[model samples]
Target: MTYIWTGKRWAYLAMVIDLYARKPVGWATSLSPNSELTSNALKMAYESRGRPEGVMFHSDQGSHYTSHK
Candidate 1:
């Protein structure tokens, strides 16, 4: 997860990468850095990859990533 300045306000970005592929498979941006942001990115990656099984996820353990929301 990261944030970028969009000229007006900061925008939060959540990304999911396929390490084996060394590329991003899904991403989402929002004004708030929260669990929903990460969830949306993960959901997109899951759906885009046809909802594969036994997949593993990794993160920096940010609050949003660890949040119960």
Candidate 2:
């Protein structure tokens, strides 16, 4: 899961959940949320759970989750 500052200086967080385990895996936040904000959450997921061979991640249609640029 990835969370970035929601308002006024990225002071909030978002939680990432694992569907397979139905558990809260990783969370990310920053004063200025950006690609790296979510990236860190993804990295945390892997580090804590070990590298997955074919892990599938899902998320709602959010800018951070969809923006490629």
Put down candidate 1 lDDT per residue, 1-69, tens digits, no spaces: 888999999999999999999999999999998899999999999998999999999898888888887
Worst 10 residues of 2 by lDDT: 1-10
Q: What are the lDDT scores of the predictions, listed in order?
A: 0.92, 0.70
Q: Which candidate is the best by lDDT?
A: 1
Clashes of each: 0, 3
For model 1, the run of ten residues with the poorest summed lDDT:
60-69
Among all candidates shown, the one with the greatest TM-score: 1
Candidate 1 stretches with Cα past 4 Å from truth are none
Q: Which residue pairs clash within candidate 2? A: 1-16, 3-14, 5-10
